[model samples]
Target: MSDPVLVIGAGVAGMTAAVELADNGVQVVLVDRKSTIGGNALNLYKAFPTDDCFYCFEGNRWRPGIRKCFYRSAMIDQPNIELMTNTIIQDISGTPSKFTVKLVIGPQYVDPKKCIMCGLCVEVSEAFALESPQCQPQAVTYDPSKLDEGAKKAEQDCPTKAISLDANPSEKTITVSDIVLATGYHEMQPVAVDEYGYGVLQNVITQLELARILDPNGPLGGRLVRPSDGREAKRIMMIQCVGSRDENYYPFCSKICCVFALKHANIIANERADGRVSVVYMDIRTYDRHERYYREAREAGVEFVRGRISRVVSTEDDTLEITVYDSLLDKYLRFSIDLLVLSSALEPPEGLDEIIKTLGLKTASGYVGPADAASEDEVVVGEHVYACGGVLGPAEIPESVNQARAVVSKILQGRK
Candidate 1:
C-alpha cells in the first residue's frame, strides 16, 4: 500500500491539502490536536463578510473565489479525506518523498457517523440517572469518563446503545509519509493586562465573548445586553488594541481587529435601538480585503474614535468610565458606558510552542516562522505541510481560504 500523507492541524490549509491530495488518488491522513477539526475559526461564533450566514459565502471573496470549510465536523464530512479527530502527531521525520509520524488517538465512545442527533440520550439520562453536568448536547459527544452511578444509567438509557462511558483507548502510534501543520493562532487573554480587568469585571468582556452575544446563532442569539444586569445597554465602549501593539503585551498589530471592532459596532446598532457604542482605537487598521467591510460599517452609523484609551474604572452606578486621548481633537475625554468590549490581540495558539517544538519548528515575534521559501500568499511549507488562517499570521477569512487553496494546489501537484 502507498504511504498516506499526514496533514496536521485539520484547519483550512490542512483540510484543503488533504482533499486535493486524496482527490488526486493520494491516500491522506488528517489529524488535529483538538478533539474536533475547525481549529480556532470553528470556535468563532460567526464568520466575516456575510456575518450570521455561514453557508452562503463560497470561495475567496477575491481571486477565483471558492468555498472552503473552516469548521471541524464539516471538514470531516468531505469525501476522500480521512479525518482523525482528537489525534496528535507526537513526532514527525522522514525523507522528502516519504515520512514517518507517531500519532496518539483519543477514543470516541460514540461514533459520530452513528449519531442520530437525537435528544434521547440526554433526555432519558437526566430522568433515570445522574449524568455528567457537562454532558454535551450533540449525540456525537459520548462522555469518556469512567462510569459513575449516573453514567451507568445513561448508558442503559441509550436506545441506540451508542453511549460508552468507559471507552478510553490506550495510546497507539501510526506512521505516515509527509506532514502539514495548520494549528491556528490563539487570542491573547485580555485579562493579562491588569487594567482591562477581564475576569475581574463581568461587564468588561473580551472580544470573543462579545462575538458570541452578537452572533445570531450564539448563546444570546444576537441580543446585545449587559451580562451583569441583563438590561438593555444604553452606552457601550470598545477598547481597541488591548494586548496589541504594546511592548508590554504584544508588539504587533492583530490584523483583523479593526474590522472585528466594526463588526461589533454593527451588531450593537442592529441589536439595540436606542444604545450608542463608541470604539476607541489608536488607529483603525482595516487593511487588505477588510476595507470594504470597514466602509460598510461606517455607513451603518458605527462611531469610530481615533484615540488611545488610557484607563477604565467602574463608576458608582456600575457603569465603566473610560479615559481616552483623542488624537484628532488632541483632547482627553472620559466616557461612561454600560459595557466595555476589549479588542484583544492574537497570540500563538494554545500549546503552539509545544507543538512547534515537537515538530522542530520555530516561531519569531510570536509568529511561527513559515517554511523556507514560503511567500506571504503561500501557505504550503514543504511537500505535505501547510498552514492557513491565523496560524500563518493575522488573516481574515478570505486570506485564510485563499492560502488554503494555494496550498491545496501545491499538494495536488506534489502527488503527481
Candidate 2:
C-alpha cells in the first residue's frame, strides 16, 4: 500500500497538516532538511497580535511521566506518521494520485535506537549540544572535522556506543497519494538595502536577529544587549521596510514587518518602562482585531515616527546616527541610538526555485502563487501539489496554520 500523503518542510504548517491527516487514519511522511521541525518559529521570542509565547511548553524536564509539548512530540508519537529529518528531496515525478519522490537521507550522527538521553556526551564536549529546542530523535551528530580529545572521550564513555564516526548517506523513494509543499521562508539579507547601512553600521541588526536577542535561550541569554558593547539598549530605533516595499529591492509588502516591529517596541517598553523606543515606518498596517496592539503600544509610550530613513552613519563612539525624512513633520531629523533594528523582508526558502520549475507552479512577486487564486481561493499549485505558509507568500504564524488546515480539507474532500 502506498503512503497517503507527503508533507514537505516540517514547520508548524506542515506539522498541523500531517497531524490532521494522520489522526484521520492517513499515513503521512513528514520531511525537512533541518534536524528540528520548527522553522522560523525557533528564531522568534513571541508572536504578533496577542504576543503569546512562541514555544508552548509545560511540566518539568526531569520528570518521566510529565506531558511534553504537543508540537514537539505529537508527530513522533503518531504511529501513522513518519518523521524524516536531514532529508533532501532530489526529484518529484508522476502526478495527482501517484507521486514518486526521490530522496537522499543523511545520518543523524548518533544511533537513535541505542542512545539514551543521558548527558554524558553533552557534558564531555559542549559542541555535542544542539541549540534547537524540542529536537526530534534527540541525538547529536559526530563530525570528524570538528572532533577533538573531549569528543573522543565522550565516544569512549558511551555505554551503548551509539556515536558513529562513519555513517554513509543513502537514497530512497517514497510514493504518496498527495503532496503538500509548506516550505516556509528565509529572511532576505539586509546588506542588499544600502541606505539602512546594514553592513556599514556595526550596531545594526535585522528583526529576526532582534527576536533571537529577546529569546531566553539565545546567545545573550535574553538580556537584550548591544552587540558592539555589552550595554543595555537605552535608545533603540527600529526602521521598517528596510528591504521590503522598496522599488530597488523587493517591491512587495512583507505584511508582517510593521506589526512585528510594534511587538518588539512593546517588549522594550515593558522591560525598561523608560526605554526610548522609536519606530520609523512609511505607515502602520495593523488591520482587523489586531488594531488593539497598535493602541496598546501607543499607550505604553512607544513612539511611532512616520518617515523613511535616508541613511544610518556610524559614529566615532561606535553608536549609530540615523537621518530620517519625517513625513509628518516635513523635515529631516537626526537621532543617535544605541541599537538600530532593520525590519527586513521575507523571501521564499532556499531551493524553492527548482521545486517551482519542476512542478510548473505559478509565481507571484517571486513567490509561489496559487494556480487559480481568483477562482479557487486556494494554494493549490498543481493537480495534487499544494503550497502554503511563507512558500505561498510571507505569512505570520496564524495565517500559515490556517492555510495549512484549509489545504488538508481540500485534500481530504477530494479523497471522498
Candidate 3:
C-alpha cells in the first residue's frame, strides 16, 4: 500500500495538522492511543470563568457544539482526515522521507457511530452497581472495577453488550511519508511531593481536584467541601507553586498557575457570599495579557499574599494550619482554613519515554523528545517529522494552536 502522511496523537495539534494536510491535498492517517480526541484539555471541567459555572454543568456551556472543547469538532470531520483511535504505533522504520508504521488497535465494543449520546449505557451500568464516578459517561471504554460488585448482574444489564473489560485487536503495519508527534504535558501528582500531606490530609486538595469539586457533574456536585467531612468550606487557602519555582523541585515558574489560582479564588468568592479565600505565592506572574485578569481578581477582593509557605500541618480540629513568611510584613504568619489547595506543577505525561524510544525520537527532561539544534530550548520538528503544542513546551491554548499551524506550513512546504 502507498504511504500516507502520519500524525501521532489526537490532541489539538495532531488533529489540526491532519486537517490542514488533508486540505492541502495530502492523504493522512491520524493515530492516537486514546479513544477520544480532546486530550488533557477535555478532562478539564470548564474553561476557567468563560464556561458559565464549572461547578454547575456537565454538558457544554452552550450545549452540543464542537466549540465546547478547545479543539473544535469541525477539525475532525474534515473529509481528508482519517482518525484512528485506541491505536498505538508499535514500530516505525525507514528514513524520515518515507517510513513504515506498525500499529496496535484495541477494540471499543461501543462503536461511536452506532451509539447515540442518550446515556442508556450509564443508566444500565448503574442499575447493576457497576458505575464508576471517575469514568466519563461518553467514554467508549468501561472500567471493570465498576463492575466488581456485580459483574454477572452488569453483564446481563448491558443492553448493547458494549462494556468490554478485555478488548484486543489484531496488529497491522502500514507505511507513511512523514510523521508529526504532538503528545502533550501531564498533570503532576500532588501526592508525590509529600510535604503538604496530600494523600494523608483529606481536606488538602490539588488544583485539578478543586476543579473537579467545582464541577457540577463531579463527585461533589460543585459544592466546595472538606473531602474528609463532606462539609461546605467557608475558608479556603490556595497555595501557589507548590512544586514549581523551587530549587529543590522544578526551578522554573509554571506560567499559568498564578492566573489559575486567581481565577479559582474569584469564582469561589463570587459564588458564595461569605466565602473567604487567600492565595499564597512568592511571585505573581501576571506578566503580559494576564495582568488584566490579576487586576480583576484583586478588584473582586481576593487576597494575594506575597510569601513563601514553609509547611502545611493539620490541627486537632481537622483544620489545616498554613505557615508562611510574609515578605511584605517581614513577619511569619499562620492561617487555619477548612481547605488547603495545592497549585501543583504540570509535568509531561506518561508513556512518552517509551513512545520516544519506539519512534527513535530524541528527548530531554525525562519526558518528551528534545528540541532542534537551532533552538535548544524548543522541541525540534525535523523536515519530515514535526511536533506541536505542549509536547513542544508549556503554553496556553492560543500558543498551542499557533504551533500547530506552523507545523502545517512546515509539512506543506516540505512536500513542495
The TM-score values for the models, in the order shown, are 0.85, 0.91, 0.84
lDDT of 2 by residue, 1-416 (tens): 54579999888788878877887788999999877677787678888644655566331234344354565577778898998888989999987789899988986567766777576887887547655445565565555567667887887898889876557888989888888998888888788677777877768989989899887778778887888877887889998887788788789988888778888888888876468888998878876677777888899888888988887888887788888889999999999898999999887778999988988989888888888878665678888888778888888888888888888888888787
lDDT value, candidate 1, whole model: 0.67
Which candidate's lDDT is highest? Answer: 2
What is the lDDT, from 0 to 100, of the residue 230 in candidate 3? Answer: 88
Give the backbone clash total of model 1: 5
Two-way TM-score contest, 1 vs 3, winner: 1
Q: Which candidate wins on TM-score?
A: 2
Kindly give the number of clashing pairs for every candidate.
Answer: 5, 0, 6
| Global lDDT of each candidate | 0.67, 0.80, 0.69
Model 1 misplaced stretches (Cα beyond 4 Å): 55-57, 60-79, 123-151, 315-317, 373-377, 382-384
Better candidate number, 2 or 3, judged by TM-score? 2
Give the lowest summed-lDDT range of ten residues in model 1.
128-137
- List RMSD in Å for every model shown: 4.5, 3.3, 4.4
TM-score of 1: 0.85
